[model samples]
Target chain A: MSPLAENSGPDIIAAVIGLGSMGLGMAQSMKRAGLDVVGYDITPAAVDRFVADGGRGAATPAAAAKDADIVVSVVVNGAQTEAVLFGPQGVANAMKPGAVFISSATMDPAVARDLAQRTEALGLHYLDAPISGGAAKAARGELTIMASGSRQAFDTARPGLDAMAAKVYELGDEAGKGAAFKMINQLLAGVHIAAACEAITFAAKQGLDLDKVYEVITASAGNSWMFENRVPHVLAGDYTPLSSIEIFVKDLGIVQDMARSERYPVPLAAAALQMYLAASGAGMGRDDDSSLARLYAKLSGAELPSSTKEPQSL
Target chain B: MSPLAENSGPDIIAAVIGLGSMGLGMAQSMKRAGLDVVGYDITPAAVDRFVADGGRGAATPAAAAKDADIVVSVVVNGAQTEAVLFGPQGVANAMKPGAVFISSATMDPAVARDLAQRTEALGLHYLDAPISGGAAKAARGELTIMASGSRQAFDTARPGLDAMAAKVYELGDEAGKGAAFKMINQLLAGVHIAAACEAITFAAKQGLDLDKVYEVITASAGNSWMFENRVPHVLAGDYTPLSSIEIFVKDLGIVQDMARSERYPVPLAAAALQMYLAASGAGMGRDDDSSLARLYAKLSGAELPSSTKEPQSL
Candidate 1:
């Protein structure tokens, strides 16, 4: 074989240690990009589905990571990420030296820094790569990644990063900056969604048709990407959880935590976070983030469309 | 001229009092539509500008309204609108019978309703037509008018409205609902603008280039129309007062008052109102609304673009 052919050979092994929405898609993308990808998940169905999509299934993190060149953690939170990397039977213990870990979760920057320190001590590279774009983008291998790490780590993880992300922002040579950027992005996303819901609900209260309000706002300066994307879910009365209310609860909670630590007053983000918390507590946690409109419906005594029957009439 | 052409002659007289940004352009659009438009302003220079733009000059609202078929109040706030309409030298006492009063000031719904009742009692029609789409659109006769009133009122005002607004939301056959919808629109608009400032400011604190943030966010779900529109003003450091910070202080104060009366919690709106109030307190009341970004810069110790100097670092 030519030297180029040898360089592109199947000897490059990567592991994805979680196969949830983001992770499963990422695993499939990696596999389709011609990498020998080993995916492991706590749920057998997730692993089976990944395998069905041409992924190589591994029973455990150790099984997945043994001698692997990279391990990508796309779990729910930093805690799950920590467990996958350093917990009992964790991949870090089994992965080869010089293997890089691309941690792509929206997490506290400090936690990312801590994870970086811990992984580096274990003779591994850690790339703080917090991703944006939702699951659909993830499935299409078109995610935007806000990443920070050492040059060697980026070099080691280049192929996998290129495969997974359409645009990767090289934030800095530190672990926490990527997380900071993601937090800022989350702050705007959450506030825009909540504000959109408020406008539509206020329109409803004013007796203008909600549909017309949605249409006008799209044309007006009141429009937002979140508003345009999420309001339709409210209009359709379909809460099929493209991104759940709990996700904002987590993301905004991180924002609030960051603000508190920084002694910053994030009143809008705080209010939005509370609304997401209220939505989750009201048992709409699994619903789409657009279900935030339901909170407005509750406050105004208005009705919203629902998939089944009447959705308890708000 | 033929009888049909003679019947459609420019005898349909109207006036847009207070030749500020929105008012001046609206007056021009009226003149361009072949109406006999008499423009009035307290500022002699504004009157001069109106005269230069093919508008007949009037020293007072009464003078403007004497023979006019419609009087559009495009003043600042409720107090100014009241002064323009019912003050000692107000136009209501002078407007011709069967004429329409298209009130385009952003005022409280209750205030609008009261004005409508009074205007209607005077044998004049009242359309609660609060205008949007800023100065450029106003000049192009493409402003959006959130209007509501009786069918008779709509009919009497349709010619003037047709010359001014590109799209008109006929909310209902009530006076207050148009103002209510405008207040709600302002609530979301103010909050989203402030939120955009906050997020961009936070990103700047994290050392991301503000322009890049603007570019990515415009393409991402984090963006709002306010973000895409107003942020450029901040980036250019051009606070040329397209819309002043005090506008939001008044609008959001109205929103809070209305929300409080209904016992509705509008935390995001409330937070945004305070920020605008802060901007006002910081002596930016007359600055562009995008100057709210300055508050975040002051708080976070992030350097903002210079007003006089080009943003060399960007």
Candidate 2:
């Protein structure tokens, strides 16, 4: 059946039940793609902003999700997602039967499996569709989605999926695979950024000009997406939190938990986690993820860039 | 005066002693660049290869250095370097007057400075010129040389340096800076390769098809030079040594020493060092650095591609 047919049939409207960086972007993308988007957030400003952006805004989850064809939960983690969908006055009951709920947060695979089973019991489809790409890509509808679900769920969610992501990796006809893939991506991304910071700061301490090191590394084999993206923040000394140190504190924690559960020893991931923890503990948690480079500078007593420099860190 | 004029007038012919992966490649590059290159090694087979490749092969360091303008030591480490250049029956006393010595191994920067001072006091010029690029690039006379020396030393070694290196980073007119730059490069190269291993192995553990993961990552920002170069060896399950794990064990050791002396903490480098150490301890020191992924697989109890699957891990 055509994806648009679902809305004309018994399918309800679509609810984007968060208005954070990623959620607001996805909501705009869904609206742009002609989905009936209803956005809600705990803060009135978020709801108002969604309304200002041509998406319908509601005061509460129940109001937004009532009769919704798909409720996309894009909150911080399992607890926030659970509260939004299954908490007191939550949206699960309000979402129409046969509707699909796409969860796009990076969470534990076990939690994903559990959520999938719970949503399935409600006669709803649950597609674990954790996403990548930062805020800009999200707003442009160019994110990458790692998704898994039954064929019916895939069919039910494909329109919104296509609207929200540029690349959709259909991991399997199951829930946890999406979460697993997202976790793997997170593990590498986090480690690479932290390693870039360590290497650059160490270069600086060795008396190599930070800018020269960045230039050569970017041109050489030592470069990574994270390295190319994050080292400028070090050279510019800007620590604006595009992604916060706490994000890694959370993400690498997920990696460590997964590895520990599987008896997998990931020493590099573990070491990188400790460095992020150090950054967060040093009152830079709210600063940009590039602030982790500050941890290297702090430990080495090396000088980093300051506001006198340009503001482009990423 | 032109480099040739200086070399021909009271000229010193330089012998590169080692003729291993880097040495033979460099000796050939120097020969192609028209330097009076003499290549030496303990292994007659390697010496034969150097001779066949159009380099002058000498039986002993003394014979190689008797009329040498420069002695380029390209051995494994400081000990081999010192043994070939400054030990009993060393080439230091055998070298013609006003000759230069260029140390090309990745050793402690302190050693570079010490050697430079000692050699200069002995009325010989010294240029600390550490080379980069693998054997393939080296053989094509396209290596990157991190070099530093006094004006006379630089002038003296310019002929040979120009012949062998595509990029010569004139770090400073000091001895240790070249070694420092090399240590920084090693820090990034080592960590990047290990991080790539962690990433690709994690993808495998997540059940994403290895080939698919390679294709996607190569297209994505996750790609790095090391990732692109080394991952194929893992996919093929061929661990034949190209750049061996033992190489990192030594290079990262130099980085660690550099960091420790400078009190610069390098958690990422440290973590990567441990993985190489594990690979070495597992008796894979002689295997290609790509075998690092197998170390990750063994630690995680994940199945690696076997000989039945690909026959080799190169």
Scored by TM-score, the top model is: 1
Ten contiguous residues minimizing lDDT sum, candidate 2 chain A = A3-12
Q: Give the TM-score of each candidate.
A: 0.92, 0.90
Candidate 1 chain A has its poorest 10 consecutive residues by lDDT at: A1-10
Off by over 4 Å in 2: A1-13, A309-314, B1-14, B219-222, B309-314
- Report lDDT (Cα) of residue B90, candidate 1: 96
lDDT per residue, candidate 1, B216-240, as tens digits?
6777678788888899988888887
DockQ, prediction 2: 0.55
Model 2 RMSD, rounded to 1 decimal: 4.2
Q: What tens-digit string does per-residue lDDT give for candidate 2 at A44-116?
A: 9999998887678888898888878788888998778788878987888888888899999899898999989
Q: What TM-score would chain B of candidate 2 score versus the native chain B?
A: 0.91
Docking class of 1: medium
DockQ category of candidate 2? medium
Error of 2 at A190 (Å): 1.6
Per-residue lDDT over B283-307 for candidate 2, one digit per residue giving the tens place of the 0 to 100 score = 8889888888999998786766675
